[model samples]
Target: MSAVVLSVALSASASADMFKPSKAEQMKLGKQAAAEVRKKEKVLPDSDPRVQLVKRVGRRILSTFSEKEQPWEYSFDVIESKEVNAFALPGGPVFFYTGLLEKFKYEDELAAVMAHEITHVRREHWAYSQRDANKANVLLLGLSLFGGRRDVLSATDLLATFYSLKYSRQHENQADSMGFDMLVAANYNPDGMVLLFETLKQSSKGGKPPEFLSSHPDDGNRIRNAKTKIEKSPKEFPALTKINL
Candidate 1:
């Protein structure tokens, strides 16, 4: 092969390798990201009673799921902002905005949300995205140095972010399923998921919805999906009254 072709082949191989970061490496990067996020955003200490309560409930739900054994640590915070967003970082760090908690009429509903976020960590979706981002970064660096255009590097970064967001949506769906299962296993109301989604949908109709709802695809179809799943698995649906606050 010509030198140019050989170089291209080498670049492709390196790019391919970039796509596969070891789980350890991905977790390391995710922890780094979480630290940065904490610095910029208000994160509650796990020591607080309220935070501990969240951890207790979260742990109970997480126990039902099978995932890699990681040092899972859960934290709760009441963000002063009205945004209803909640997320979990790869290694086990989780956050729930106060806006979401306040909207729930019962503790079981809150458990549903917590279970969903925990599912994200348990399923390793965040780690997968981190691996993808690492690969994209590597590819972009290679293209910047090689015969590829600089504009391609910029485009790659943009595309990587978009891909990350798409993965996030998929993660949300997987979490939804896993979370429902977890709630059922823990004997929390499975309908809480549907109710939470309906609340989100209703909240979106009046004025501007919280950032969480805005960033996420509206709960319209998701609400329906949750309900359908509940209907199909009646045995898994626990009595809402059994959940202790």
Candidate 2:
């Protein structure tokens, strides 16, 4: 399908998924998962400037969606840890770590990051991935029972892991595309998505990849895809003045 058609399809049915968890269930799961994260990690107070900054950007993105467009109860929080990481739960909860937050040099760049994570939730990526992985595991279980070989089970388990990771990478790409549309619709710089991936690529040089990249598409491919969208959709995504970080 053409990019324009795909974009329209995504906008029209952002929550459509073949997964088991319904939107209400996703919301409940997100709330429970968020609570567990808060208990295990040191979440910065809402009063903190960092937390407020993230919320400010998050609110701008949320404003682009009408009540009917967004069924999830969106919330944003910052963690105290130094890991270069951010993630969204099943529904609308998004978390940013200090290390990753500090790397952002502009508001649009931060918006790029937040929008990508939020799209994962809006797209029900976790629920879809979990359901698919569970199915694969069940098959593996059946194989183990019939064959009764530890080595076969272990190999199948590894194959399942590989499939799960590959599926996650596909989700990462989807989130990138949807999030780029969102960033522009929210009147943030369309280039922010490309800029963010370029920065990530630079950071991953000559070292272990950031935890953030573990399940994401290759940075180079993401950057290129974002640029293509920007170039192809100038009318739909008008350029905006970028705010400094």
Candidate 3:
């Protein structure tokens, strides 16, 4: 009856494509995207306190990945921006915005954010999205060439579709569930994910919404979903603990 369960019932169809991008391909695409981001955003130094804390949380999360689930290489970066946003690229590139980092006083909350982003990579959402786009374009191109159909959806439509892709609600919920499991497995507080969602909801009240909330929506349902997941997780978590950065 939960929203997460309902979402899974509706959207958890197995993808039909069997030829997803390989790890090398994902790493190549990630490196390219990361370089473009680096050219525009100022990268924080290794010694910056916020950067250090993010890296620590990132590594801890990375350590919890199962062997077969390990990404090619994990590299976390702090971007110098005031907008509250963060994201992970296809392979292992993760970025955090300074505006977001300054708001967190504990590593658990930070871990929540990083774990969510990491789930996107581990789940191969980006590569699958790209694969879908490519298939559509190829089919459109073929129809134009062979079937003499030029009035099909335009390239602009394809671009719009790609950019406008909000990860399905099911994937978002799965990320929350997996991130909760990772927190419990690694001895971090699962409540941080819920706390992060609450903080995002609060910050969006008086002003513009944080950029993080744009792609990763934080409706109350997701918070409740995380709470349910924590309560039911099979991991034998010890007494929940909190740590200051």
Off by over 4 Å in 2: 1-19, 142-167, 216-219, 236-245
Q: Name the better of 2 and 3 by TM-score.
A: 3
Ranking by TM-score: 3, 2, 1
Candidate 2: tens digits of C-alpha lDDT, residues 109-156: 889988888888888876687566544453443322124332232223
Q: What is the TM-score of each candidate against the true structure?
A: 0.71, 0.76, 0.77
For model 2, what is the error of residue 5's alpha carbon versus the real structure, in angstroms, after optimal superposition? 40
For all candidates in order, the CA lDDT equals 0.63, 0.71, 0.70
Query: Which ranges of candidate 3 are over 4 A from the true structure?
Result: 1-19, 143-165, 206-212, 233-245
Highest TM-score scorer: 3
lDDT of 2 at 52: 92
**Candidate 3 structure quality by residue, lDDT tens digits, 73-116:** 77899999887778787788889998888777567778888888
What's the lDDT for candidate 1? 0.63
